[model samples]
Target: MMLYIIDSIRTNNFHGEQMMGKIRTLWENASRKLEHHQNNVYGVYNDYESDYRGDYSLSIAMEENNGEAFIEITSSEKYKVFQVDKTDEQGMFKTWSKIWKQEEIGLLERAYTYDFEKYGPNGEIEIHIGAV
Candidate 1:
């Protein structure tokens, strides 16, 4: 998969920008800039210093490069997918918490590559975690 970035932030979930609303703010700003797209937005996670507990680069991106920064994932790569519950107000956060817990317990092996959240045009959402 290849994506063009609208905005990016370097952050870790613990003792980082998440609690300070940086993630939320990035998404908000990116959302506005993405209005001309096809309604499909991606939240890309990459450049992991270590793992989820470490700082990583997160970008709001789309398939059309639009002359912006971009990331590409190998075609044969694998991922552990988490479908978001659109009805849950804390759906994204809850799902991410689950991913971290699963990884910690050895239930999931993360690749620390290019993970992504796909927000589809039809309101469906899924998180694709790069897997080993």
Candidate 2:
């Protein structure tokens, strides 16, 4: 299924610890602003270039009509989804790390265009990794 999103680039070139910091900051700011929309918040990883050092754009977006005003409206292709229950306070980074590990173990090849997180009104979340 296609997802319509409104997004912004929260970083340029960053990796390792620096990248993690940027991700955290981006989420913190975005999450606060998105609180008004409740469960409509979504995060996207957009890579413009092929290399690891290339530009990495992290965006926190909301689906159309989900509430917050947006800068860009974009659409995503089909994805291979992984659902995780936020039963504990394990945090988003660890959850994402687990998802990436799954990706590494032949879950699916990343499409590299974009990958997104879908937040439920409840405590659950779905990581929608774009797949070829």
Query: Per-residue alpha-carbon lDDT of model 1 for 1-132, expressed as tens digits?
Result: 678889999988897844459988998888788776786789898889988888888888888867367788787999989999999999988999999899999999998989999999888999999899
CA RMSD of all predictions: 1.4, 4.1
Which candidate comes out best when scored by TM-score?
1
Candidate 2 structure quality by residue, lDDT tens digits, 35-112: 666545677777557632457666677655543444342454667777765775765656667766766787666777
The weakest ten consecutive residues by lDDT in model 1 span: 11-20
lDDT, residue 51, model 1:
82
Steric overlap count per candidate: 0, 0
lDDT of 1: 0.87
TM-score of 2: 0.67
Candidate 1, 10: how far from true, in Å?
0.7
Give the poorly placed runs of model 1, Cα more than 4 Å off. Answer: 17-20
Candidate 2 regions off by >4 Å?
Answer: 1-7, 10-17, 51-55, 65-76
lDDT of each: 0.87, 0.63
